[model samples]
Structure formats: C-alpha cells, structure tokens
Target: MTIGVALIVGDTLRRRWHTDSPGTRGQEFPLLAAREQAARSTAADSTLASQLTLPEKPSIAVLPFQNMSGDPEQDYFADGIVEEITTALSRFPSLFVIARNSSFTYKGKSVDIKQVGRELGVRYVLEGGIRKAANQVRVTAQLIDAATGVHIWADRFEGELADIFRLQDDMSQRAVGAITPMVEHAEIERMKRKPTHRFDAYDFYLKGLASLNLQGSKDAADEALQMFYRAIDLDSGFASAYGNAAFCFVRRLVNAWMEDPKKEIVEAERLATRAVQYGSDDPVALTSGGFTLARLLGELEIGEQHLHRALELSPSYALAWTHRAWIRVFQGRPDEALPDLNRAMRLNPRDPLMPGYFSVMGMAHFVAGRYEEAASWCEKAIQVQPKFLPPLRTAAASYALAGNLQAAQTMMSSLMQLDPRRRISTLRELYPLQRNRDWELLTEGLRRAGLPD
Candidate 1:
C-alpha cells in the first residue's frame, strides 16, 4: 500500500490536496481558508495574561481522527466519528466538552499532547485514527491525561461501513461510559486544565469568542467585534454571534474604550435585539442579549424576561446566572444578586472569566453599601486581571467610600490610565444604576477620588 502526501481542508467537511509525488508520504498542512486561518492564528497568539485555571468538572476535547486508510475520501468518515463523539459527550452537563470548531483547528498538525492540553485548557485529550477497508471500518481511540501524559484508556472498534452511523453511536457511547467513571475517580487526586472542534459560522464565532475572552486590550475587543461580524456574514441567522457582538459593545462602553459611545450603544441594541429575536432557544445567546439590553441599553423589563427564559432552558448555565445577577443589581436587589453570582462562580469554578465574576461580585457589594468588602473583592479581581477596567474602577469607588483616600486615588489613576475619559460625570450617563442611591454613591466615590464632575 502506497501513501502519498495529503492536505486536509475544513473541519467536518474534508477535501484532498493532491501532490506531484504519488508514492511517498509528504508533509501535511491544514488548508483552511486563508482568512479563517489568519483569525484563528491571531487569536491564538494574543498574550494570555495568566494561565487559565482548570475547570472543576472533567473537561475534555476529542481531536480530529487521523485517516489511517491513506485514502483522502476516508477523511470524511474520520471527521464524522469525532463530530458524533463530541456531540454525544456534550449532553452530559458534568462534562465540559470543548466545542468542535475549536478542537478541529489542530487537524493535520503534529502537536504535543501536553501543549494541546495547555492551549485548549483541557485536562484530558482523546485522539484516534480510522481505517477503512472495503465494506469494513476499524476505529482506534485513546484518552490521555494532558497534564501527566498518562494513558487512561484505549480501545478499538470494528464494524461494517453499512452500519457507519450506528457504529459511530456505539463507539461514542462506549467511550463516554469508559471515561465517565475514570474522570470521577480522578477528580479526588487531581484538579486541572481545554478548545473547540467545528463549520464556517461556528468556527468564526469560536474565534470571536476567543478574542473576546482574552479581554487584554481595546484592540482585542475590536478584533472580536469584527470576527463576530464575519460570523454573522457567513450565517445571518447565527444568533450567538449577534449576542456576542452586542456584548462586545457593552464591554467597550464599560471599559471606556469606545470613541463614540452613542453609536456603539445603537449598534449594541440592534445586535441584542436580533439575538433575542432569532436565538430564543439558545440559552447562551439569550443571556448575552439580555445582559446587553439590561446593562447597556437600560431595558430592564425585557432583559429580565429574556434572562429568565434562558435560565429556564438551561438551569445550570453559569453565564445565565451571571447575567441574571446583573439584572438583580439594577433592580436594587443586590442581596439577591450576590447569591446568584456566587452560583455562577461555583458552576464554572475555573472559568476564564472568573475575574469578571469577582468584579461583578464587588459591584453587588458596592450597591449594598458594603464598601470594605467591595474593596476586598475588587482588589482580588484586579490581582487576577490587572488590565480589566471595571474592577479597577470598583476598587477606587470602594476605597473612596471606605475613607481610604490615598488608595482610592491610586486605583483612580490606574483606571484613568486604562481609559482616560472616565469621570464622575461620565459614570452617571454610562452606568445603568436604576436606584438613585446607587448612582449617588458611585459618583460621590469617584468625585472623592478627584475625578472631574
């Protein structure tokens, strides 16, 4: 059997790259579209400020299966196997499965399993190859501990191609059953580390999400907005992209990164409206759209409704809890919001956005007039993500209200350096605090820090 060089393109869909040399194996390159590759590569390069903590739940990603048959046509079958397994694993709420789009980006690349674990922030990696001969197919898979490079399980399944779908399902179930107990047992001895595998719209959305999650600088935020826009271009009905794009605008507004707040707000409203309209069934989209409305557009009533619907759809959705907590703060119910925020942190203990969660927790404390506690939580958030703006501002306000003028001024300077335009006068307009007392307290603290009125 002679194997030649092959180039693989796309995630779920596979295309063959023919080489001039037919008999010898040549180096393989993932031939994803140029623009998509650029965006993904750029997103990957963004300096991660801190190592992301491993999720409390067992997180895993199934890499694209190798086409061992040496036939380009068999690439589709291998991809299908991974896709089916990933989807099957996602049904378990306890298992954090990296979405397919993010995972598939590693296809055709020779990556170290440990590095793959760090890049994706997953504790376990599942890798395998597929071989097809005549009417029969053989699938081999192994699960590895990314942190230690230890093999937890390995197995092979063989069946006729006519039963391909059933074979895939059976293989998935077997793999899941084997992994579940191992993960649960390993939970006691270990703690740590995950990415996605998938299509044009989804791939673009994942890239956009990655950019947004970095939240390192204003440029990253702008890039995320553009990526989400591209995702929407690829699929006009991609509600999650719209939701995320709207959330990007909200991020810009809060961070004081926007050059034109009014224009961005209008854009945010439009995107949020579209997300709510088209993604009624998607809990993540609904929650993001709802947060944009309530926090940025000040549409509390409608936002609350969307958030409630989102929670109904996904009771354990950590992000929905985060959004709902914000709404609770707006309604002048900080006490209620704090517990909800805590729940979010518990659900995703090692979430990349934990800093945001901590900062919001400080906001809840601030609203409740617990200035000292607020400052403590804000400082904790700042220690994790020094570049993040909200926590800095919250720290300043909390310090000021607690009568620590020097610390307050230092925090204020940090916030000003991050976004020079923020001031006491600006806070009233941009911040959505429905209670007059809440607004007054925030401004008074900022004014005490010597911000211009």
Candidate 2:
C-alpha cells in the first residue's frame, strides 16, 4: 500500500495563439489539415470560412497536469490523472479528444494557445495542477477557448488520498460537464462513467497506456505489454490491463510478429476471458476483451454480448462501435456494420488510428460486394500505414475482385515483402472469420491476386 503523492491543484490560466507564418511549428500539421477540411465540409457554409474552422464535434486537449507536490516521484500520479481524464473525455462521441501523446508534447513547456490549438487542431484546451499533502490533495483545473483565450470554466476539487480514483473520475466528469454546457447547451449528453478503484494498479495502467500510444515500433508494443503485465501482476483484478494485454497478443499474431502463435493465442484467450469475467461493468475492458474473444478466439456470440453490453453502458464509446462493426463484417453482415463504422468516424474524425478505421470500412464494403469502393477505402488505409498487413491484404483482395489484376498483384507483392510467409492457406487460422461466406469471399479474392491457396 504505497501511495507516493496524491493529486494537488493550483490555479487557473488561459491564453490564445495566432498564426504568424505558413510553416509555423504547429500551424502546418497534416492532422489539423484533415480535420479542418472535415469541419468545413460539415459546416456547409462559405460565410464561416472567415472564422476558425471547428470540428463538427467539440474538440479538446487536456494538457499534462503539473506536479506541484515538489516531490518529483509524484510525477507519475499527475500524469495518471491527465490520462484518466483524457480517456473519459474520449468516451463521448460528441467530443473530439486529442490523443495523450499529441497533447503531452507540451508537458513542462510554456506553450502558446495559438501554437497548441493549431498543432493539435483542438478548439479548446484544459490545463490544471495538483498539490498533494499526505492523505489529502487539492486539484485545480480550467477550460479555455483556444481561439479566444476566454476562460469558459474553472473548478477546485479536494478529497482524501483514499478517494484518489474517485477524484480523478470526478475531475474528468466535471470538466466534461462544464464544457458541454458551455459549448452545446442545447444538447448536453450525460453518461454513466466508471473508474478503476485501485491507485497502484491504475498507475501501472497509465504507464502502459502511454507506451501503447507510441505504436511506433515492435519494441514499443512489447514495452507496453510488459507494463500492462506488471499492472496485472500488481492487481490481478485489473481487467482493463488484461484486455489490453490480450490486444497486444492479437497485434502480434496479425502482424506475424509472434514467435509462437499457438502459445500467444492460448494466453490471449485466457486473458480475454478473465477480462470479461472481472470487468463486467467496465466499458473499455468489455470492448477490448470482447473484440479479442470474437476476432482472435472465434467466440462470436459471447464477444458480441460483451460488446453490446459495453455499448449499452457507454453508448458514446466510439471504439466499441468500431469493434462491433468489425465483428459484424466477419459475421457476414457488412451492410449492418456500415452505420457503426461511420458513427465511429464521425465521433473522432482525427483519430490517429484512422488507418485501421479506413481498412475496416474497406472490409465492410468488400463484403457487401462493392469491390471498387472497397479498393478505394483500402488504398487510403495503406496510404496511412504502408506496412499494415491487414489493409495491404485487403487492398489486394479488393483490387483483384474489381478486375484490377495488375494493381492486385502489386499489392500482394508488397504484402509478401512485409510478411514473406503469408499465404491463403492460413487465412482461416489467422482471421478466424465466423461466416463461411465471408471466409470464402476473402480467400477467393486473395487467390485471384496470386496468393498461394
């Protein structure tokens, strides 16, 4: 029972940044460009061009909470609070949350709002500080209009150290509560939010989440898995960590990065089962666990039930919708999956994982017998992640099915370069698609593209 430092709050601050040059550090981000275009199209008004283009959904960035405890060891606690807040905010489909990695780039630095807003492409920013004294903590936070430097909301929360998790949940929900009223007073949607109760386990989970966001290389994923495993060891009841650990195993298997697929699959199934069993009330845990069960273990019915419950618990959770869409396609119901996929895209238009979303959309289209549209979507996915084998394979199959043999052959060659051992013979074992028709469609396209059957 080691509680290093509880969260402490300081003061409220607000500022705005403006454009100076074409190549300003944060002004020319590609991520922002895409978001701006999406926002403009959604607005459907040329008159609004003079104003700052905001996303269809209110967008925000939660900067790293400052550690005012003076003891640097409490740094982890401060970061953990910010991560939890970010996660809670992301659960809302009507809110566009800048990922933790992008927002954390400003950690410990004096940032201009113009630069931050431009770089992150967020309309609002939340900043805060924490000060801990023994068993009690004080937390102060404020929300700002990035374009106007106006302080829309601010608050202070103080609680005993034993209620650290509750404090974090309150802080996040309160911030969302404040922002929604300020921005969307006409339609303020509320949700039943849940939090992990254990502080020690949560600390490790936060660290693991940060590592998972890296996704830059295999080393990063492995490190994330290690951190998640440590969290599970510290608290075997930490279901979210188990769910994430199972996902890491799925990633390895899909990318052909696993040295022993049989062993990893067994471990993944065990973790997924445990995650669902223990995390019956946790939406994130249910989403990830259900996805792993259906996608990797072929347990479609149980997986769909968990996912359905997750959505019922947190209807605005975009990831759960995305996973449900994925399961639907494998269930030979691609038409039914399209709405969920589109809903996911609208919820987080600037998601860093848009490549995967695009690839899934392509799969939905492919299964609906729309080969050309499928090829187009898969191309976008491959553009975002060239070496992403799933999208690569999807692109090849779509192209071949569309009668573009040359393009299909080119895509297959690229896929083979990434995974030299890939073959149609193992598609069933790898994808675990439940519907026979869906499996046949996938295999037939790949075979037409020259994949060894």
Candidate 3:
C-alpha cells in the first residue's frame, strides 16, 4: 500500500528495507551448508583469484531496475533495457540467473548484498539503477561478492536511449566475461535460491508459481490466481504478473474448475495478449503467453515456439516447466509430462499448487484409462491438500471408472455441497473437451457418479 520512493540497480533506494528486523533478516537466510562442502572440496587450483579462468558459474539475480526517468511514459523503455540485460546474462549458460520473479522481490527495498547472496544461493549479485532523461539514459552496474560484501566490478554508462540495447549487450558481455570460470567451478555445488519474503506482490508471484505444483483441490489454485491478479493490479504494466494470471485462468478452465471454460478462455486470451504487449521482452510473459495460447486456444506450433523462447530466456522457471508439462499431457504424451512435473516439484516442493501437479498426474492416468493408478495419485493428492477440487473431480471419475460408484458418488456429493452451482450446462462449459476420447472419459464418469452436470 505505501508506494514509497525507491532507487534501482545502482543508486541505493531510500525505502524502508522489507527486512527491518535483524530477527527477520536472520530468519530469512540460513548458513550455506551446501557451500561448506564446496569450501572443503579441496580445489586443484587452490587460489580462486588465480583460477579466475575457471568459470565462476555463479547464479546471479538481476533485480528489477527502477525507471528513474522523469516521464512515467519512459518506464517501459527502462524496464525493457533491464530485461535485455538479464536475458543477455542468462545466455552465458555457464552462469545461472535467478528467475526475474525471485529477483524482483528486492525491488524498492534496501537489501544487504550478503543476505541477498545467501538467500538467492549465489556467490555474487549484479544490480544497478537506471536514470533516463530526454533521449539520454544512464545505467550504473556493479558486481558484488555476496560472501565478502565487496564490489568486484563497478561501472557507469551514459548513452542515448536508442543505444540502450547496445549498452545492455556490452554490460552483460563484460559481466559474463568476468564471472564465467568462477561460476562454472562453483556450479555443481550451487543450491538454487529464491527470496524469502512472502507478503509482497513479487513474493505473491513466486507463490503463484509454487501453486502450479498443487496436487489438486481448487482451494490453493484459487488462492494462487488471486495473488496473480493482485500483483497485476499493483503494477498493471507488470507483464509477467498478467501473463501468469491469464495462464492460471486457462488452467482452471481446462481442469473444469470454472463454470464456463469458454468464457474464461476468452478472458485468458485477453490477459495473455496483454502480457505480451506489455512485457514483450520479459521471459515470464513470453512463457505464460505461449502457455495460454497453447492450452486455451490449442495453437500448438506457435505456442510451443513461444514457450521454447521463454525457456531459453529463463530456464529455471518452475512454472514454465509445469506449463510445458501440461502441454505434453494434452498432446497425449502423459508419460512425457511426468519428468517436467517432477522437475517443478523438486524446485519448489512446498508450492501452494503442488496438489494441482499431483492432480494433473492423476488426470493423465485417468484419461489414459488407468483408473487404479489415477485413484492412487488422487489419494496422494488428497493426502497433500485435503480440500483440493481438481483431485476431487478426478477421484469421482477415477473411482467411477473403477466401478466404485459409492466412493465416486461420495466425492460428487461433496463437490456439489461445497459448490452447488452444478448443472449439465455449467459442467459442459467448465469442461469443454473437444476430443471425443477426453469427453467420453470425463463425462461418462460424472454421469455415472450421478452428477446432474
């Protein structure tokens, strides 16, 4: 609510640091137990400085750069420049860049570089502030040793706004060039990092990503969607936020959580397009855009390409992985979706939507006509999230398919009691299955389970 003044990448922002309490800061980061093993690994090249040629392989997070330009109109341009730089840094492949959502957690806040390093599981961090005036832009960047709280590299560039692309490429190349070997040597031992904050819009986005892992009740998923919408309202031009929100809507539509899948898909389309238009360069927007198009519109080729480009830009995105997994399941390759789902689960096991992922697995099995397996997975989902909705619908169908009418009816009754707006018309809209096989499988069970819809 308090939109305090804050600086970006380089100049220190004056906003109250989110972690004002030493206790909060201490609770935010745990010691690098994983790094301890790396420290004692007894490197063949004992001197890190001497062996600087060994790719630094540090995973750096580029926090959101503030649009310090006087004109609010220039905000998008500044953001585009920062995104370009982040993309370029991610390209090194040897260097891992934290997902933008995670980095944006520090936006508008005063942060301790060491705390950031520890929280994000990076040995170093690259951050700066952007100030643009007239046609000219100034970007200041610095690399900090998260462990020692020292700046390893710092530089400032003043250039025409039109030349911002050139500046991004140049800065990113130098930064990557500087840390390549150190990152590589340190890569295997690195623990993936994310910010510890939980209340802000940025944190909400991360939680939204985590929600993609849900095993199945609609409760957590609805919660995630609210967060995504909240984030978008907080920053309308925040394309990634919009993109994810749209994608979540599409997921709800596909899984029959909505009363009208057709109408919801239309809304999903609009949100996805808004994301791309607003965040043309943001990997998150691109990825979510692709996912929405693929899942809701069923445009496989273009959607797949967009998703691929997004992954290329931000490979560590757990949501992207889950989206890809969902795409595969729809493509009739249920087996293939498993690995991607597994990866997402591993990345954030405690994600809010974890039950959804488990439910997806269950749905895949049920659709594949493996009723027993579907029931088992649905049970697993129930174990994780007792009130999740998708798994409930899935269980109803799975049990019905297995000829357990009693159990199936029980789930159906629970669903109706929890949400009484059930009717065949509403169910049809919610589960718009174009495929005969999919329609038959889902519809038959629901009908058999005695749901009017």
- Report the number of the highest-TM-score candidate: 2
TM-score of 3: 0.54
Question: Per-residue alpha-carbon lDDT of model 2 for 7-64, expressed as tens digits?
Answer: 1111100110001111111111112244543432333222122233467777888898
| CA deviation > 4 Å runs, candidate 1 | 1-198
- Give the TM-score of each candidate: 0.64, 0.75, 0.54
Angstrom error of the Cα, residue 39, model 1: value is 27
- Give the per-residue lDDT of model 1 (tens digit) for 285-403: 78889989998878887898999887665555667788889888877899999888866654443344456777888989999999999999888667656767888888888899999
* Residue-level lDDT tens digits of model 3 in 154-186: 999888755655667667766765776454523
Runs in model 2 lying further than 4 Å from the true structure: 1-80, 89-125, 129-140, 145-149, 156-163, 176-196
Q: Which candidate would rank higher by TM-score, 1 or 2?
A: 2
Ranking by lDDT: 2, 1, 3
**How many Å off is the CA of 356 in candidate 3?**
2.2
Clashing residue pairs in candidate 2 (N, C-alpha, C atoms within 3 angstroms): 8-130, 8-131, 9-130, 9-131, 9-138, 9-139, 9-140, 17-114
RMSD of each: 12.5, 11.4, 13.5
The stretch of ten residues in a row with the least summed lDDT in candidate 2 is 9-18
